[model samples]
Target: MSRGVGLLLVVWLLACSGVHAQALPTQVSGSVSEAKTRLPIPGATVQVVRTKRGVVTSTTGDFSIEAMPTDTILFRALGYKSQRMPMGGIGLSQLVVRIQLVRDSVRLGEVQVISDRPDRAIINRALRNIKRPAPPVVSGAKRPPKPKPLFAVDSTAPKKPVPTIASPVSLLYDQFSREGKQRRKMEEIEAEQRAEKLRKARAEYNKAFLDNRGYTP
Candidate 1:
């Protein structure tokens, strides 16, 4: 029984050793610095751009990561240019590289402006020229001028003035007075003429009646 237990312990130890031999290496440790300043830079994202593997640098600019395949050690930060290290001749399993970041260039933005207005030639000239009508000749008769409007009025009806409140009563009164005076004069003349004719007609009737009655007219 004791010999069996000792053999079991040896088998367990040998199995553990084999497992350790097959286990993968955890990571590669590294640091990053600025190319110009030669100062350590923290927070640079160290990536293997080709394999999509990466990690951010620590506050002390140190990083620990698994190495990826060739031409793929890509380093980047917010305001810095990216850097790539070729791993063609180097074994990534032995990778412990220092990265150098350069400051990125800033480009100024561009703008374009446009405005709208009529060109000078277009506003000054007619689209097409045409002959104008000849002016009428003056005559000795002193032609009655086109009568100036009774009132300078609306665009549609220049001869008719829209009388305002201040002048309306006076305009109305003048109109009514002229009508009444003309009517009164016409009636007076008509009445006088009618009275004379009535008198003449009565004399003629009376003379005819007297002559028929055998009396002198």
Candidate 2:
């Protein structure tokens, strides 16, 4: 085969194996309706989670979204249930879906969340706060000079705080030192016991030796 013919064959093979992107932008248009009542839901926000792009439903509950590669659209309508619908797997597929959103039942006993702490009836009853007006600002006037005591009868007042051996940690440290000293004394006592044992052993051997010599000591 000629070189040009081989190159042509290679190009044809490559084109056959590869897939091309949609030559134009694809649009997916749809209407949102209540699943239970079949009523149109207006102002619902629809999003393509895969592409992070979305659109809102119109007054008539109609919505149009530009489809992106590998997109799964999620729809959220207030007072109605959310929905998800998959579109176009790898290639552009024309889609016209009628999304059904059901109104969520309001369960009075269900757990409710608030952005900030709301005053509960139980808490409001427990707290009794008095609202006081702000004091007038004194800009230039000097605060009345604190009046001096009219009479100074005694220079000293009884100590409010009973003389605490202010250094409690120092006392603890001293107690720890005393305990350490006691531990060392106990160690010395144990050593003395071992030494006494040795002395007794020597005395017994000497007595035995004297007995063997036929001279009692």
Candidate 3:
């Protein structure tokens, strides 16, 4: 009975160990960086070669994904070269990888673009063949002479007699008009002289006031 119990116990222990090994996940965690600078490369794609499972690196260029130990992980970025690394015999719990990607360069071929427009020689030839119209000619006929008068005519008429202020009333009216004009002219001249004098006096006062206050301007 003791021997049978020992055999059953050994079988049960083996079965539990197999179950634990099968439950282990095939996963990996890693970081991607630039090969030259060792700087983290974010937004890099980490995909399994034979499966649809993939993950993108975080801001720190760290990524984790589920993949078999024998499967390949591809890292791709916009300007960097693509890299493939096989997860060969890597432990599931302690798989820490640091992938460095090299830079990719693509050189384009030189292309010469030819225009479909006509050459300058062809344009000059077409212009030379064009015909231009001649200018119009003027008439040679002479103009007729101006007509002359038939009879002699008077160039001037007789002068009329000039009238003078012979009456007393007329003479008085003329004298009064002359005196009124003279009075108005004298008043205007006096008024202008008074204004000029006042302006000069005010300007002199302002200048003296400014000078007393020590103002140069």
Question: Judged by TM-score, which candidate is best?
Answer: 3
Arranged by TM-score with the best first, the candidates are 3, 2, 1
Worst 10 residues of 1 by lDDT: 149-158
Provide backbone clash counts, one per model. 0, 0, 0
In terms of lDDT, the poorest run of 10 residues in model 2 is: 154-163
For model 3, residues 1-217, the per-residue Cα lDDT tens digits are: 6999999999999999976765566767889999999999999999998896799999999999888656788999878999998877554655778999988887769999999999999999999998888876668966688765422243443332233756766555545678756755776787688667656655665674645432221
lDDT to native, each model: 0.69, 0.71, 0.77
Candidate 2: misplaced stretches above 4 Å? 1-18, 22-25, 88-90, 106-217
In candidate 1, stretches whose alpha carbon ends up further than 4 angstroms from where it belongs are 1-26, 69-71, 110-217
Q: Give one digit per residue, the lDDT tens place, for model 1 in 62-102.
A: 99876533345778887888887755544335557677788
Better of 2 and 3 by lDDT: 3
Ranking by lDDT: 3, 2, 1
Candidate 1 TM-score, true structure as reference:
0.36
Those runs of model 3 whose alpha carbons end farther than 4 Å from true positions after fitting are: 1-16, 19-23, 111-217
User: Which digits, one per residue and each the tens of the lDDT, describe model 2 over residues 1-217?
Assistant: 9999999999988776554554344578889988877878889998988668888888899999877545688999877677787765645555677999878776668778776765797567666564668999988988788766433333342222232477677556545677756765776787688667656655665675645332221
